[model samples]
Target: MSLVEAEIKPRKSLFVLKTAKTLFGELDALVADQPANSTAARAIVLAHMRETLVAARADAEAELLATSKGIRCAQNLCNAEDEIISAIHLFATKRVYPVDNPSEAETLAVSAVGGYGRGTLAPGSDIDLLFILPYKQTPWGEQVTEYILYMLWDLGQKVGHAVRSVDECLRMARSDMTVRTATLEARFLTGDKTLFDQMVMRFETEIMAKTGPEFIAAKMAERDERHKMMGNTRYVVEPNIKDGKGGLRDLNTLYWIGKYFYQLKTSQQLVGKGVLSAREYRQFQRAEEFLWAVRCNLHFLTGRAEEKLTFDLQPEMAERLGYAKRVGMLGVERFMKRYFLVAKDVGDLTRIFCTSLEFNHAKDMDLVGRVFAPFRRGKVKIKGDADFVIDSGRLNIAKPDVFTKNPVNLIKMFLVAGREELLFHPDAIKQITRSLRLIDSKLRNDPKANNYFLSILTAPQSVERMLRQMNESGVLGKFVPEFGKIVALMQFNMYHHYTVDEHLIRAVGVMAEIANGGLRKELPLTHELLPQAQ
Candidate 1:
C-alpha cells in the first residue's frame, strides 16, 4: 500500500505500474522465509507475489474512470487484469506441480506479464510470470500431468495462480522456440489463447521434429528488437499526439513507455540468471507486487473496477517518474507533443519539440538540459561525424538535417552527443553554483579578466527566460511559484556590453550547457577544466 512505486533513473524517467493490489502482505513474508534448495520454493514464493499484483489491478480499474489522466492509464488496466488472472494461474499452480525436472519453462518471466507488463509495482512484490507449455514435445501418454497438477495445488496456496497452455495465449503459434520466444512482449498484457492452444495442440510437434538447438534459441533476438523499438530512434517519425499545454503529459508518457519495456527485459534477465524461476507462482505475482504504488494513483484516476482507489497523485510524486519507453523516440514523441509545439531550429530536439520563439532565442534551455541528460551523465554517448556541425552566432550547433531522424532535441544535441564535458551530473545546480562563485571571485580581482559566462547567470533572470520559452514553445508548463518571481527582476545592466539583463540571459544559457555536458565543447570557459572533464 505504498503511495507510489516507480522506477526513476536519469536515462529512464518514471515507470509506475498498477499491478500490485493482490499480493500486498503475502509476498513480503515469502521472500524473508524462502525455503532452501527446493524447486517448489520458487513456485510458492511467486504465487503469493502474483496475487498481490492482481488484487491491486482490480482496485485501479475503479479509479481510472474518474479523471482525464485516469482515462489514459485505465485504457489498458483491464487488459492488464485479464492478463494478470491468466498469468497468476499459470505461475502459482507450478509451485506444487510435481513435474520431475521440468526444465524450468521460464515461469517467472512469462508471469512477470502480470506486473512489469502492466506497470510498476510496490517493493517486496513478486514478479509476474508466464510459461510456454511443452505440450507438443511429448505425447499425453508419455508424461504424468497429474504430478504437475498435484504439485501446483500443494504449493499455490489458492492465491494468484494461472497458466496458459502455449497453444492458448498466442497467435500464429510459433514452436520453433525462436519464433515463440521473440513474440512475447513483456510490455503488453495478453493471454492469447488462440496461439497458446495451437502450440499445445500441434505447433510444438511440427517444430520439435526438425528444430535445431540453435533454431530454438531466442536469447539475442529479443534484445535486438527491443533495441530497435525501445532504445534507438534513428528513423522514427514524431507521432502527432498533442497534450494541449501544461499537463506534463509528455513526461508521463516517457516514464510509462520506458518502464513498460524495462520491466519486460529485466524480468527475462532475472529468470535467465536464476535469480528468479518462472515455473513457480510469483512470476506474474511479483510483477504485480512491484506495480502497487503506481496503480494506487491509476486506480484513483481510472476508478477501479473491483476495489476502491484512495490515493492522491501529487504529494506521492507518482506521475513525475517520466518512464514509458526507455526514454526513446516513442516516449519522447509523446512528451514533445504533450509539452511543446515543434518548430524549425538548429537545436538537438527542435524538429519535433519547441517553438519558433524558443528555438530562435534561448533555445528552450531547460529542456535542452533534460533531453541531452543521458550523454551528460555518461550513461551513453550519441555519435556523429564532426562534419555534421555548424556554427550559429559563435555557438557550435548541430546540422539541422542530421537531427531530422533523432528524438534528441536539436538545439543542444551537438554538445550533448559530442566530445563534451559531463553536464548530466545529477548535482547540476550545485556545480553551476560553484562555477559561478569561481567567476564571481575572478571578477573581483580584475573586471577585465576572462569572465566565466556560464557561471554568472542566476535563476529568475536567465532561468526565467527558459521557463517562459517552455510555455511559449509549448514544451513544459511552469509551476514553481518561487521560480516565477525569479524570472521578474532585471530590466537592463552596464557590465555586460549587452544589456545587464542580456548578459544574465547569456549566462543562463551557458549555465544550462555546463549542466547538460555541452559547455566544454561549445564554450571556451572550460579550457582549464577540459582535461578533468571527459
Candidate 2:
C-alpha cells in the first residue's frame, strides 16, 4: 500500500522512524569510513526513505487493525508519526549544522514557511526554514543568502533532507509540491518570530515597491541562464525546465500576459460555471477586484491558447496540470513525490520556454489549481469584514501558520504590529485622515457623533465583517427585502453597514429607495445596492 493509504499511513510511521535511524547510521558509517564527498551518498538516503515508507505502510496497517479506533484514528496516527519522525529529522538536521560554527547575521530568525511554518508537519516531510536575512537590504543580503544555502548544502550531505534557504523555499514554494503540500502546513521550528517577521518587512519595503520594474529585469536576468532562475524584487526563485524544453522564460512578454490573463481567465470561468447564485457570483466579483490589486504571472513566449488551458475547462484539466480529478486532493507529499522530483521539475520548467511561449494562456498551466483555494476552503478565516482578506496595503494579517515566513506577515508583526504602534505613517495617513474628516467633519461639534465614532474605534476590520456574516446567513436579505429589487444583493452593516464591500450588497437597495431624489447622493453610504436598511 502507498504511504498515503489511509489504513496504513498513520500507524506505519514507527517502523519508518526506525528505518530512517538505521539508514542514517549506515550513511554516517560510510562518511566516517571515507571522505564525505567521496562517499556514495545519493543511494543511501533514497534507499532509506523508500524502505521506511514502504515498511511503514505495512506496519501502520497492522497496528490500526490491532488497535481499531475510527474517525480520529487516522489523524491521531498521523500526528504520532509526525512527532517521532520530525524529532528524528530535527535531530539529524541539527547535527549537520555543527555546534562548532554559527552564523554571523546580527539577527538570525528561523521561520517555517508553508506547512512547517504553520506548525503542521507530516510524517516524513522536509523541514523548511527561512533565515531572517539581516543583510538583504544591504550589500550583505546576497552574500548572506548564498552563505546560508551553502550551509544547507553541507548539511544536506550529512542528512536526508537539508534546510532550504529563502530562495529555495520561495522557488519550491511555486512548485506543484509546495502548493499542494507546504502552503497549508508550514510552521516555524526555531528563531524568534520577530526576526523572521522583520525579514519579510524589509523584503516588502525594499522589494515590492519596484516589483513592477524589477520583476521584468529579474526575468531578463534568468533568460541568460536557460530561464531556470526567476527573480522578483526580493529573492530569486527557481523555475525547473521540463522535458525537451530548455530555457523557456521570457519575462517581458510573460509578465504582461500573466497580469492581463489570470483575472480575465478567472472571471470568465466564474461565468462559465454559472453554478453560483447571482449574489454569490457578485461576491466572487470582489475576488476578481483583488486579483487586479495583486498581480500574478506565468507568461510564456509564444503559443496559441489550448482548449485545456481555457478557464472553462472541464474536470480533466486538473490531471493535465498534474493533479487528480476535482475530488482528488493534491496534497504536499503527493506533489513532492511525483512532480517536484528533480527530472520532472527541470522538464516542466523548460517546457514553458520552448512552448513557443504563450502569453495569457496559463489557465491550463498553474499546477497550484485555483489561486484562491485556501480562501475557498475557509482554511484562513478572514478576521475583519472582508469576504476574503489579503495581506496587502497598510493593513495586514497573519494566519497563525504563514505569518512567520511570508514577508508581508513578518513586517506587520515586527514594525507596525503593536496596538500602540498602529499609528499610520504620518505622510501616508494624512490623506486618509483628511478623507475621514471630510466624511465626518461634523462629528467634532456633535458629542453624540464623537461617542459613536469612539465606540467603533477598535473595530476596523469588523464593520463589513459582520455584514458578511449577515449576508452569508441570509439575515441581511430577510431584514430588508423591499430594497432587494433595486439593489440586487447589496446590503449595509451597522457602522459601515450600507457602505463598503461586505454590507454594501444588501444596503444598496435601501440607499436608493429611502432617500428621495437628490438627497440620496448626500450620504456616503448612498449606493443603489447596499444602502442602510435600518
State which candidate has the highest lDDT.
1
Q: Could you tell me how far off, in angstroms, the CA of residue 243 lies in candidate 2 after the best superposition?
A: 29
Q: State TM-scores per candidate.
A: 0.26, 0.25
Per-residue lDDT tens digits for candidate 2, residues 64-158, read 33443221223332333334343334323433333344344433444444323433222223445445444334333344334334433443321
Instruction: Give lDDT: candidate 1, residue 266.
Output: 36
Every candidate's lDDT: 0.32, 0.31
Task: Pick the TM-score winner.
Answer: 1
How many clashes (backbone N, Cα, C below 3 Å) per candidate?
Answer: 132, 61
Model 2's lDDT to the true fold? 0.31
Residue 296 lDDT (model 1): 40
What would the per-residue lDDT of candidate 1 be over residues 180-292, giving only the tens digit for each residue? 43233233233234344444345335543333222212322332344344322111122111121111122222222222222223333434433223531132232222223
* Candidate 1: segments with Cα more than 4 A from true spot: 1-110, 118-131, 135-295, 298-534
- Kindly provide the TM-score of model 1 when superposed on the true structure, using C-alpha atoms: 0.26
